[model samples]
Target: MIDGLVGGRLYGEAQIRTGQNGKRFVTCKVRATTNDGDTIFVNVIAFDDEVQTALLALSDADSVALSGALTPKVWTDKNGLIKPAVDMVAHKVLVGYRGES
Candidate 1:
């Protein structure tokens, strides 16, 4: 597992779900742009109470930065092209206040 920080815009609204063990957690996707203009999606999950609360307050397209464990992944697109992605177990969440007065 790679520990890193990723900043991006929320791809969709975060979801809260319960596990079979009766534990609740949050999950969300972030669309991050590469320096070369490519877009990579990060699947994020947070179990910490603070992180979960911060994610739940965010909306789609909201800017956020997260720090935690990252796992590299690859997925095939509709055109059969393989794209890279990351799965993050986020421990910290930072929501950007851009465009807010």
Candidate 2:
């Protein structure tokens, strides 16, 4: 597990799910660009109330930055292409300004 920050656009609208213990959490996917010009997907889950609220308010493709625990992973696409990915236990969520000037 690595502690770091990731910035990207939300791949889809965030979803809320209830745990087996009846606890609710938010989950979302972020598509980040790698240094090598590749795309890396990050699966983010937020348990904190503030983080969850921030994530739930954003729409698909919204710019976002998150800080938390990151776990590197590899996933295979439908075409059998291997892609890099990460699982993030997000503790903080940063969103772009939404209010009018």
Best by lDDT: 1
Task: Give the alpha carbon lDDT tens digit for every residue of 1-101 in model 2.
Answer: 89999999999899999999999999999999989888899999999999999999899999999999999999999999998899999999889967887
Measure candidate 2: CA RMSD.
Answer: 0.9
- RMSD of each candidate? 1.6, 0.9
TM per candidate comes to 0.94, 0.96
Cα lDDT tens digits, model 1, 1-101, are 89999999999899999999999999999999999999999999999999999999998999999999999999999999999999999999888655766
Local distance difference test values of all predictions, in order: 0.96, 0.95
The positional error of residue 38 in candidate 2, measured at the CA in angstroms, is 0.9
Candidate 1: where is the Cα deviation over 4 Å?
Answer: 98-101
Weakest 10 consecutive residues of candidate 2 by summed lDDT: 92-101
